[model samples]
Target: MMFEPFQRLTSRTIVLSQENIDTDQIIPARFLTTTSKEGLGQSVFFDWRYNTEGRLRNDSPLDGFAPSEFEILVAGPNFGCGSSREHAPWALSDFGFRAVVSSDIADIFKSNALKNGLLPVEVDKKTHQQLMKTPGAEVTIDLESQTVRIGHDWQTVFEVEAFARRCLLDGVDPLGHLIKQLPTIEAYERRRDEL
Candidate 1:
């Protein structure tokens, strides 16, 4: 699969201000039955966005905002804190979020996200509050510089592992990247056989 490079992204943001949002809440367990990533986007944050009757909640934040208008999510502390399911990141990515900004994120989730080509950005509490304060604001995430630009003249730096950063900037998943180096691997093997 061809992954999109995440160098610089400037798009409207959606803030889920509540803390400790888990994988189940993000996509729910019932939805996890499918191995395919397709259609998972529609179920993202499914429980929160719907009622018990499977009807769209009148007060759903998703209803208030179209997915096309936003590509970034500004979430509260301890985001992605539930089960270490890879589907969570897949759901988020399928839902049109290229990156998620939070004050704190679960380590396993962060690693899963990075592998899936989703940038998980951790910012200071102050910066997180600032981002939440301006929901729908156009935020710019510069993966190249490892910074999130909030509003005019205000920006905060984020940390991503160098290898993960390289993968994201290059738009290649780990397996895909290794696959792309097949020629070099073959050449090395041939040379070793001759020796």
Candidate 2:
């Protein structure tokens, strides 16, 4: 899937300062029935967003905020830590989150997120703490510089895999990246056949 090209993003953040937020908490296992990525946004954080009767909880943390208003999710440590479910990132991306910021993100989740065009930004402990404390702060994520900056004073660097960064900058998934090389691949094949 070709995602929106992520060169730089400047947006208000939504802070979910709960550690060990696993994939199930992101998108419950029951909602994983369909292969489609569409409409998963409604079910993202389904358990926390609704009651047993399926009504929106008045006291829910997300009650007052709009997903479109907050594109970056500042999560607590060990975010996306449970099963290696790609659906976690799928639901997040579908919910209009372009990036997830944390002190530490689970490895598999990071990989899944990158492939799906959801940037997982791993920053230092102090930076994460600062972000957690400041809810709804406007931040800038510059994918080219691998930096996250909050206002004129605070800024931090994060790391992502090189190839994944390239793909994200180009707005292509791994498959899409490979598909772009088709002309060269066909030329190589033709040469091999001639030889």
Candidate 3:
């Protein structure tokens, strides 16, 4: 069996209005030059979050929050709208973001997140804008119903790639998904090996 549908993600929300935020922005190319999740957190959106000297400053949009404290990222249209780097999801996951809510996402990026267990939910422009302004925008991603509720009245219907949704619902890794039929796999392997 795969991951039983997720219940909720309750944590601090990060607001990222700048759209077309690509993989490089999430984890710069320079950082991509390391494999450790160890320091990737510090480099997430390094260009936007820190200064030339690698110092954390308070003059940015994502101020007053750190990676460890934030779990939800509310971003603008076409968020994650750039290069198809798998490292992007790695950085987000290692940084501790359980999910991301955006107006839209690049096809590849969305797929990448799903494999890492990070949800990429789509809420239309109106809901996206509203979520941007919702102080703390506590987003509850209900996998059972495919709806995202931001407080009481603010609810939006979200969609994901069908296979990705199924993967999340079943908690099956890409290969584990195939291995889900272990009996069949074992039978086939035995037959082939015996030959």
Candidate 4:
């Protein structure tokens, strides 16, 4: 899926400091019936967002915060640690998060997130602590420089897989990136056929 190109993002963060947040917590298993990415935003953290009676929870971390105001989610360590579900990132993306910052993100989850246009930024423990402590702090994530900066005070480098970074920079998923090279691929095929 072609998504909004991610070059540089500067926005306030939504901090969810609870560690070991699995895919089920991100999007409960019961809500995974639909394959559509749309409308899943409502189901993102559904259990936490609403109570048993389907009412919004008063103590939810996301309470009183508009998703539009926060593009980055500074989550606790081991974010997205459970089963490999693309739905996790889908729901997050639909819910308006462009990136998830953490000390350590699960490998499968991170791969799925990157493919789905959700930048999984793994920072050092100190940086993660700083982010977790300061809720609603303005931060900047620059994909080109591979750096995450908090104003002029703190800045740190993060690593993303080279191909994934390229895809994110161009705002294209893996398939989309391959599609863009079709003409060259066709040319090569034609030459091989001629030979």
Candidate 5:
């Protein structure tokens, strides 16, 4: 599927102020049985979202954002810092998070997220603090300029790899981007055969 290109996103924030939120915590090992991403959202952060009785926790940020669709998740430093499981990003995307803003993100998780149409926007510590300071604040992410605008007066630049940025802006996954270049690839192959 051609993932929709990300340009500008304006949404309320859900603060997940936990550091080193590994893939297992994001989506436990037990929930990884499905080949399909469908229904994974329900299991995203399964342990934290539910209590011992399998009830939704009253104070969980997932609970607060569940009723409403919050596009941005402002997480603590070293977000997604566990095993390199593609399922983590799948679960987050399935959960309807468009972007994850943090001070840092694990390399593998960041790559997976970009491939799956989830923007991992990294900002400075100060910016992260500001975001957490105001829960439910409206945040704007501009992919074109690679900037995250917190409020009317506060804006911070975030870095994304050039190729990944292009993919996101074009609304195409990496595979889709390669497929679009099939004609060029074919021509190059034919030229090599002519030699």
Candidate 6:
């Protein structure tokens, strides 16, 4: 998992439907068994996003940028819908998505993102409307203050959970975070042993 706290970024983004989109749809059921997170990027949004040969054709909005290159996806409300699998964000972050902006996010998905150090930004309906209209608009996610800016024209402020914020800030992937705090943890263990 890649943890990028202050990612100064630009990209062409697509705003999509707010429906029962889930992990299976995000990366397809075929890839679910894979243990490594790297190649799952190719399968992202498989069923609805690509043709049988897995080619990104002109019909879809995401086609503007090559699948390997696209960085942002502005989605509708209730995104990350369906089963709670960490693989959803795994594919996204592995696929190089720095941030995902939506009207509302599923709680489990948000937590999964935090564990992997992916930024899931939630904005109100008005901001969602503006971003949806911003075809191929580039988005900037400033983790220091948790703000998302589209081009030089508009910006949106968001709220992330405080503990999650600290983890993201220091580039702490979940595993790395636990290991980094291990000294204190070890001390606690030693005290407990004494008890």
Deviation from native of the Cα of residue 123 in model 1, angstroms: 0.6
Which lDDT values do the candidates have, in the order given? 0.88, 0.91, 0.77, 0.91, 0.88, 0.75
lDDT of 1 by residue, 1-195 (tens): 557888999998988998998888888898888968787888898888888998888586656667878989989899999898899999999888989999999999999999887899999989888999998988999999999998798888999999999988988778877888999999999999999
Per-model TM-score versus the true fold: 0.87, 0.88, 0.82, 0.88, 0.88, 0.80
How big is the positional error of residue 106 in model 6, measured in Å on the Cα after superposition? Answer: 0.7
Clashing pairs in 2: none
Clashing pairs in 6: 26-45
- Candidate 3 per-residue lDDT over residues 1-195, each given as its tens digit: 455354566665778887788787887887776755464665677788788887887776556666666788888778787787778887887777878888888889888888888898888899888888874766677876888887778877887778777778777777865767899989999999999
**Model 5, stretches more than 4 Å misplaced?**
65-68, 177-195
Model 1 Cα RMSD, Å?
3.8
Number of backbone-clashing residue pairs for each candidate, in the order shown: 1, 0, 4, 0, 1, 1
lDDT of 2 by residue, 1-195 (tens): 766788999998989999999999999999989978788888999999999999988575566677788899999999999898898998899889999999999999999999888899999999999999998999999999999999789998888899999989988779976888999999999999999
Residue-wise C-alpha lDDT for candidate 5, range 79-163, written one tens digit per residue: 9988888889898888889899999999999999998888999999999999978878899999999999987989999999999
Which candidate order results from sorting by TM-score in descending order?
4, 2, 5, 1, 3, 6
Better of 4 and 5 by lDDT: 4
Clash number for candidate 1: 1
In terms of lDDT, model 1 sits at: 0.88
Error of 1 at 101 (Å): 0.4
* lDDT of candidate 1 at residue 76, scale 0 to 100: 85
